[model samples]
Target: MNIGIDIEEIKRFQKLLKDKNFIELVFSRDEIEYCSSKKKNAVQHFAVRFAGKEAVWKAINKSKKLVITDISFKNSVLGKPEVYIKGKKASYIDISFSHNKTTVVAVAVSSK
Candidate 1:
């Protein structure tokens, strides 16, 4: 099993979310839509998703050929975050995320 974690500041994440190019280049359609639906704490949600992606990448330890947007989140029936890279699935990956006033953190574990 490989584990990876990431953290992001809420204010910084909100700032980056305002940049269309950054969003377009770093997030998938579902991710953008998911954050849009959050409304109240969209930045926190987006940041967690971003952290999820980063942690997943680190766990996979793949080449840099994979971009940020290459990883995405999909909720399960219980609204649990599931990880996917490109169109491939990784059911073995476990994800956890949390946030507060200043920051959000996410951890991912990939067991082969």
Candidate 2:
């Protein structure tokens, strides 16, 4: 089992979203919706997604081919966002995102 967690302030996310590629590199539709529902800024949501991707990469041993789209959120019965790694064996991933007026943070954990 491996775990990787990341957190960032909202202002940092605001600046990073200026890069179009960065936005496209992360964020699944469900994640965007989840962030939007939490009243987080679009850029902040994107940032969380980016952080989630990086955390997942780190947890999965940094596979170069693990693009953002390769990981997705499938809602559990409890409505939590369950992480899925495409075309792989059963694994576990946990992701969470939170934001205040000035900061946003994301955390991810994985199990082999």
Candidate 3:
């Protein structure tokens, strides 16, 4: 198994969100919708998901650059985090996220 983790400041993402290109380039449509759904806490949600995609990118250990939008997420019926790659559920990957008022963190373990 391979593991990767990432942490980011929520305020940084709050600033980045002002750029529409950044949002479209990094987040999938579903991700945008889901995060936007949070409304007031949208920045926190986006930051956490950004860290999650970065963790997944590192866990895969790919030398080539990854298309960030290709990595997205959803919540299971039970509210567990689920990773999706290229629009399909990636069963080989397990991911988790956490955040506070100022920061967000994510971890990914790949069993590929």
Task: Using lDDT, give the best candidate's number.
Answer: 3
Per-residue alpha-carbon lDDT of candidate 3 for residues 26-72, written as tens digits (9 for 90 to 100)? 99887899999999999999999999999998998574366777789
Clashing pairs in 2: none
For residues 1-112, could you state the per-residue lDDT of candidate 1 as single tens digits? 8889999888998789889998888888888898989899888888889889888888877534677777898888898888887866779889999889998999999885
Task: Flag regions of model 3 displaced more than 4 Å.
Answer: 63-65
Candidate 1 lDDT (Cα, 0 to 1): 0.85
lDDT of 3 at 54: 93
Candidate 3 residue-wise lDDT at 106: 100
lDDT of 2 by residue, 24-84 (tens): 5566566666655756367666666666666677777564467667776655688665677
What is the C-alpha local distance difference test score of each model? Answer: 0.85, 0.65, 0.91
Q: TM-score for model 3?
A: 0.93
Number of backbone collisions per candidate, in order?
Answer: 0, 0, 0
Could you arrange the candidates by TM-score from highest to lowest? 3, 1, 2
For model 3, name the residue pairs that clash: none
Worst 10 residues of 3 by lDDT: 61-70
